[model samples]
Target: METDVLVVGAGPTGLALGIDLARRGVAALVVERAEALFPGSRGKGLQPRTMEVFDDLGVLDAIRTAGGLYPVGMLWQDGRRTGEYRMFDAVEPSEDAPYTEPWMVPQWRTQQILRARLEELGGKVAFGREVVGLDQDEGGVRARFASGEVVTARYAVAADGGRSTVRRLLGIGMTGEAVDPYPTLVADVRISGLDRDNWHIFPPGGAGDDYLAICPLPGTEDFQLVARFPEATAPDLSLEGVRKVVAARSHLAPESVTELRWASDFRPRAALADRFRSGRVFLAGDAAHVHSPAGGQGLNTSVQDAYNLGWKLGAVLRDGADAALLGSYDEERRPVAADMLGLSTRVHRGETRRGEATRQLGLGYRDSPLTRETRTHPGPLRAGDRAPDARVAGIRLFDAFRGPHWTLLALGDVEAPEPDGRTRLVRGPAPGTYGPGLYLVRPDGYVGWAGDTPAGLPDYLARFGRR
Candidate 1:
C-alpha cells in the first residue's frame, strides 16, 4: 500500500489526525493492531478544550448523543461543601468559540464517532495489521506488518499506545519514574444502591486500605468504580477480585453489585519521549508521552496533540512548507505534556491543594512564535492561546471552527477590515460583547494570532495563512 501519511494505532490520536488530513483532501491510512474496536468505558471525561476540538471535527453532537454532558465540580477532601468550579466560569465562549459543556463519554464511543467521520471523509482504519517493523528513507517510510503486508508513505505517525513498537524501533527513550507501588483496579459495573449523578470519592480512611471513586456512565444507571488497594493485600484484578474491591471500598455487600462489565489493573507512570520525530517519522499520543490518568488528560491530551500536528502535516505535504514546520510539533506539545506529567505526578501523590487555578487556568502557550504577535496579558491563557469554549448565542461555535478555512473573528469593529477571499469573518457586537478582542483563527481552530486591534493581521497572514 502507498499513501501520503501512514498513521499507526487507531486510538483517538491517530483517528483525529486521519480525520483532519482527510478533511484537508490528503490521502492518509491508519493501521491498528487490534482486530476490532475495544469495548468498555475508559477515560470517562472530556475537558473543555477537547470538547472544542470535537466540535470542530463536526461530531460533538454525535458524542453528546452517545455520551452525556457531565459538569464536574471540584471535590473537597475534608467533606466541606465548596462551590462548584465550573469550566464555563473560567473561559467565556463567543461567536467564534462554541462547545460550552464538557462531555463525559467513554473512549470507545468517542472512537466510534471518529471512525464514522473518517469513513465519511474517504479514509478507513486497517485493523489486524500489526506493524512488525519499519524502514525510513530520505523520501518516505516503508512499514512491514505481521501479516506479510508492506506499505509505504511519505510520513508515518506513531500513535500507538505506551508500549509503542515504533518508538522502540526508533530507539526513543522514555524519561520518567513510576508511581510508588500501589495496586489500583478500575471496573465498570452496575451497582443497585449508588447515586449515579455524582462522583463519590472515598479517601483511604473509612475503606479498608483503599481509595474509591465512582463516576456515572451516560445513558445507563451503572457507574465506573476506580479503587486503589494496598500493595500488600490487593489481589490480582480478576472478576472476583474487582467485585471484592468494589464492595470493600463502597462499604456495600458483595451481592449488591450484579455485573462486572470490564476490569483492568494499570500502574501509573510519568514519562515523555526523548524526541518526537526522526526523519520522515513522528510520534504522538502514548507513543510520545504516558502519565497517570489522574485528571483524565491522557486521551484528551493525545487528541489535542493530533489536532496540533495534523494541519501542519497537511500543509507540509501539499504546500511544501519548510520541514522545520513539522519540528514545532515537539516544541509546542512537549511542554504541555511535561506540564501534564507534573500535574499527574502531583495528583498521584495525593496533592490536591491547588484549586481551579492550577487545574484549569495554568494551561496555555503564550510564548510560542505563533502566539507572540498577539497583544494580551502574559499568562497561561492569553490572546494567542487555545481559546476555551462556552455557551454563546445558544449555538455551539466550536463546531463551526472545524472546517478548513481561516476564521476571522471580528471582535469590536477594529480599524482593519476583513481580508477579501480565503477568510471567513464572523462579525458580532463590538467591544465587550465579544470579549473585546480580534482573533485570526487557523483552520484547525487554534488562535494563530489575536490582538485588541487589527494591526497584527498582516503578520498573522504572513506567518500561518500562506505558504
Candidate 2:
C-alpha cells in the first residue's frame, strides 16, 4: 500500500491527526494493532483548550452531546457523605474565552467521534496491522506488518502509547522517573449504590490502606473506579478482586460493584521521549511523552500534538510548502510536552492545584521559529499566543477561524491582504483581547505574526506556501 502519511495506532492522537490531514485533502491512513477501539473510561477529561481544538475539527457539538461537565467531588466518611467541592478552580466563560471548564467523555467515545469525523472526510483506518519493521530513506518510509504485508508512505507517526513499537524500532530513548512508588488500578464498572451526581471519594481507612474513588462517567451508566496499592504489589484486575478492594476501602459490600467492563493497572510515572522525530517518523501522544493522570493533561496534550502536526504536514504534503517547515513540529511541541509533563507530575504529587494551568489555555508557541512578532508594542495577545474568541463585526472570531485555513484578523482599519485560496480575512473593530493590529492566525489557531500593518505578513505567509 502507498499513502502520503502512515499513522501508527488508532488512538485519539492518530485518529485526530488522520482527521486533520483528511480535511486538508492529504492522503493518510490510520493503522491500529488492536482489532477494535479501546473500551475504557480512562482519560475522560477534555481540558478547555482541547475543546477549542475539537470545535475547529468539527466534533465539538458531537462531543458536547456525547459528554457532560464534571460533577462536584463528594467526600465520604464511614459510608456517609462529608462534603462537596469542585475538582478544578471555577472560571466563568467570557467572550474572549468561551470554554472555561473541562468536559468529560469516555476515551472510547471520544475516539469513536474522531474516527467518524475522519471517515466523513474520506479517511480510512486499517485494524490489526502491527508494524513489525520500519525502514526510512531520503524519500519515504517503508513499514512491514506482522501479517507479511508492507506499506510505504512519505511520513509515519508513532501514537502507539508509551511502549511504542515504532519508537522502539527507531531506537529512540525515553527519560523519566516514577512519580509514585505505588500502583494504581483504574476500571470502568457498574455500581449499585453510588449516585451519579457526585464523584465519590473514600479516604484511606488506615495508614497502610489505600484510598478509593468512584466517579460517574457522563453519558453512561458506568463509574470509573480508581484505587491505589502498595509498591511491588500487583492490583488484581479480576471482578472479584475489584469487589474486594472496593469493599475494603469503602463502606460498600463486595457485591456493590455489579460489573467490571474494563480495567488496567499502572505505576504513576512521568517520561518524555529524547526526540519526537527520527528521520521520516515522528512520535506523538504517549509515544512522545507520558504523564501522571492527575491534571488530566495526558490525553489533552496528545490530541493537541496531533493538532499541531496536522497543519504542518498538510502544508508540506498538499500545499507545496518547503519540507523544512516540518522541523517546527519537534521544535514547537517537545518543549510544550516537557512543560505539561512537569505540570502533570506536580498535580499528581499534590504540589499544585488544577487551576488555570491545568486548563491548558495558556499554552502556546511564543518562542517557536514560526512565530514572528513584528509590532513594536504588541497587545496582550502576541505572536504564538492563542487567538482568543470574540464577536467582531457581527461574526464570531472562532467561526471565522474554523476549517483548514489561515485567518487574517484586520482589526480597526488594518488593511487585510486580498483573500487567497488558503487564507480567510476577518475585518472588524478591534476587540479588547487583541488591540488594533494585523494578526496572522495560523491554521492551528495561534497568532503566527502580528504587526501594526501588513508590512512583513507577505513574507511570513510565503514561508507557509500561502500564495
- Evaluate all candidate structures by whole-model CA lDDT and list the values in order: 0.74, 0.93
Clashing pairs in 1: 98-397, 98-398
Q: Whole-model lDDT for model 2 versus the true structure?
A: 0.93
User: Model 2 reaches what TM-score against the true structure?
Assistant: 0.99
Worst 10 residues of 1 by lDDT: 353-362
TM-score of 1: 0.85
lDDT (Cα, 0-100) at 97 in candidate 1: 42
Model 1: per-residue Cα lDDT over 1-467, one tens digit each: 89999999999999999999999888999999999765667777777667767777878788878777664543434454344444233345444344444568877778888999999999999999999999998889999999999999999999998999999999889998886577777888877765665666655656446677777788666678787766675555566776676666555667767888887777778899998888888999999999787656778789888988898887777755566778778888888888877876786676753334233323565666556445554333355466544333343445445586677676545555656565666665543323646777776566677777778577556644354
**Which tens-of-lDDT digit does each residue in 74-135 have in candidate 2?**
99989889998688877899998999999999999999999999999999889999999999
Q: Enumerate residue pairs that collide in model 2.
A: none
| Candidate 1 global CA lDDT score | 0.74
